[model samples]
Target: MITAAPHTTPGVLDGIVVADFSRVLAGPYATMMLADMGATVIKVESPTGDDTRAWQPPVREDMATYFLSVNRNKHAIALDLRDDDDLDTAHKLLAKADVFIENWKPGGLAKFGMDPEAVAERYPELVHASITGFGTTGGAHLPGYDLLAQAASGLMDITGEPESSGQKAGVAIFDVVTGLHATVGILGALQERQRSGKGQHIAVNLMSSALSGLVNQTSAYVAGGVVPTRMGNDHPSLAPYGPFAAADQPLILGVGNDRQFRQLTTALGASELADDERYATNPARNAHRDELRATLETYLQHRPASEWVEEFRELGIPCSEVFSIAQGVEFADEIGLAPVQLTGAEKVPTVKHPIDYSRSQVAYDKAPPTLNEDRQSILEWLDAEEG
Candidate 1:
């Protein structure tokens, strides 16, 4: 993706306007991607503000960090859809926009006069991108939240220690996944519009995206007839392929084949164990993985995880020290991921949008707005449009 450098901008979607009706993580994440791609995003928030605005004590400039994480690079406009004037203004904005994004319940928008088909009917070429708890089809009745989706789709069932009750992933994996799928749908619909000169209704939901993301595990069940189970830090099928405790800390390693396993054993100077039938080939090793893990841990516990990482990397094994969120950001910078964008230096340590387009950018990074911050100015603009 093109960098949102002030001096040089590709502006692929420069003329396009996106009327953002979504809030919170998934919707905002999708719009942020769109804004970064150069669309003008006007965030239409409810009057009390996005619920996330006051989400926590970890505030930046006294504003919630939860709010800051996603609502960047867009103009904020608060609207009470129940009020006729505000609803009229919203309709006006939608009529002129190239895209409309929302995260309401299946029939929520229809009640508000903003359903996808209605918007498409009014603006045939508008890309109506929606993210929700579930799709409008079979799972429509279910609520859409990351944890709930995880639990509903069986992801939580395979996430924790087998002996313990399954746990949700540490992060809102399903919400973020839905956001990404939303973006994909929007972009694809936009491309189709280029060809047919008419946009289509596109949607994604946490529940659907969560199920889609369980590709490997689901494929195993459907194709191989195996009900996958929680194995804690261990791989679903590959044994001795998860986190191991070194002398100082836990480190993860991906031993792909017998050859790599041999290399790992040699690194530990325990090659003799590989020849033993109990730990010989991959399958045999997997079958007796507990025994192999015990033997490996005995040797690994003699060295620091950091030291093990260095040597394991050199052995062409995929391994790394598990990092906390902060450490992950630091490591990303060290390896050129540059995941953090230091706009205004340390004052705004924002996460960069993942996609980088050579010929275009999403939106420029802008701070989140205060409640009703854009109300006066937005009303003025709408008044001017009417005149």
Candidate 2:
């Protein structure tokens, strides 16, 4: 139910066109980022619409908010690729597109002659980006769901308390990570095409992105031969680095090094604790984390979390009171981030893209469209281009 803004500015990716055949979270999220940067992304869905369109209950004007979250600033069209005419229309769109993105199974699009190999051969200049739950090899048969990725990638193994069952992230983290990887791959391929005058395939799978996104945790296993386990909110290596009770509520302390530990102890009126051999160095403090926590809480118990947050911030200590989603957004706005914007005539609020550029601005011209709302105009544009 979001619509186009009346006035707009040209974006950095103004000339690029994206043929977005991606559905659901990962693929659509990537194309949305592209659209935010000013690419003309044509989202081609099935005749029914993208699957997320039906993921409702949390609805906005009867449209799925989940769908709206990643479909903004793009035109949409419904086409049944199973039908010959609709398949031909897709081909025509690809012919004029700078990038083609999809998340179908390995051979899913082969019947329609839209497989990566076929698309690459037919549109030699177009970047073909593929997202899958797993890679097209051994794991292709498996579905590419975020929870599965979290479970398979050792993420769930290291998450939550040791005593509790493994838990998936609050959000679809791997999906978002995979989308980011796809966007990077597409942009890199586009850059390479500038010199070679040809595009290449960019394959990103959720499992692969999950491993990479795990970063230090994966490194602990692969590089150090240490299989990390769940420790709840506590960091495996960094002591005094998790949430601690602060009179009224919990405050997270991210004291990473000896210097920060010293600063924290000083701020808490417990400078003597930092001087103790058992809590002086990071490794030493980690060894006695329980004792350190017990000691710190004695001093922290006098002040509320908010007061501690302010005092610790002024002292350059990395500490914060845990915030709900609404509070997080409000904090961002209060700090002059201007994180939200109203879109379309309905004035729907959407998050602004996180990045800022000196020479070019991110576009927020169009809102998430109604199903197949731009089909006629898109087809007319295609005809004009073909002519």
Candidate 3:
């Protein structure tokens, strides 16, 4: 575990409070980001705890790493909302909170009187953000898992090789993307609230976030009248932009434009290739990608990937030898990015939040809590507020 420089300054979001009733990935991830920015996030779980508490096997001590990954810098209290006392506690928490977030199924929280409509009516000054698998309209009944969103949103359709079946991303990408979208929406609403002195409902769903996150791929079909298909690692538009065989291992080349192409060919001692009409311009190079790949490999075959990576980088060509996750972390550290932080009393290792600010710092003062670990303190605080 790597330790980052300690931040002594107050957080940018020091006074903001968030009531987080989200379980699993999307909602918790968003709340975690808020917590990192110094929001006092209270994670309200069910009596059984968050679902990720049981998603173990990759464990640190008795805790699930998956749960730990996104629950730090927050206090936790498990509340059985079915009971009147616990439901009242939840309501109290919301009364003091600036933001409320949940990922319950559409109408799932209505029975508890915690749905968006009810919350909006009750606490008009509190920003309420909802994350769902699908929208609350026609697709509300569909389960909101990342895999299902990937399948439904054309991500799976365009992933993998031309002949093989589509593959889900190694991680729950849509869930993370949806969380980021929720975070942005919540922040935007909070800013708007400063002006209007009233908060609004912010809704984000996995399927919509997935389609938007697809960016250029979806733009092709929607704007350019082209439906893209699977091409393995190769880009649909950019040529000479995928992994190529070096003498020992594969090297990824991201030669995006004519200049990079020229730099790449010249570095390989194949300067004449830059003059070839079929491989000169981006459009022409994309049209002759296969031939260009074959010709590039003929020159690349003389050197190992590592050697080519060094030379191409010096020549201002975008290239890299593939790295495993471990190596990736090491590389980040090597470049002076302290990628991990040992947080809280137990010194649990956590991947640090990726942003850097000049005035305020990201918080890593608390570790992810055990189930309902903060119940006594939270309850005392709530009772004291009532008193």
Predicted candidate 3 versus true structure: per-residue lDDT over 129-235, tens digit per residue: 99999899999999999999999999998989899889889899999999999999999999999999999999999999999999999999999999999999999
Deviation (Å) of 303 in candidate 2: 0.8
How many times do residue backbones clash in model 3? 1
Worst 10 residues of 2 by lDDT: 1-10
Query: Per-residue alpha-carbon lDDT of model 1 for 279-350, expressed as tens digits?
Result: 778889889989889889999999999999999898797899999999998898899987976442234767
Alpha carbon lDDT of residue 41, candidate 2?
A: 91
Worst 10-residue lDDT window for candidate 1 reads 1-10
What does each candidate score in C-alpha RMSD? 3.0, 2.0, 2.9
Model 1 TM-score?
A: 0.91
Model 2 over residues 1-387: C-alpha lDDT tens digits?
A: 212222367677778999999999999999989888888899999999999999998998898989988988889899999888898899999999999999999899998888988888899999999999989989999999999999999999889989988878999999999999999999999999999999898999999999999999999989999999999999988999999999999999999899999999899888988889999898898899999899899899999999999999999999988999999999999999998977656667788887898977787777798999999998988888899
Q: For model 3, what is the alpha-carbon lDDT of residue 152?
A: 93
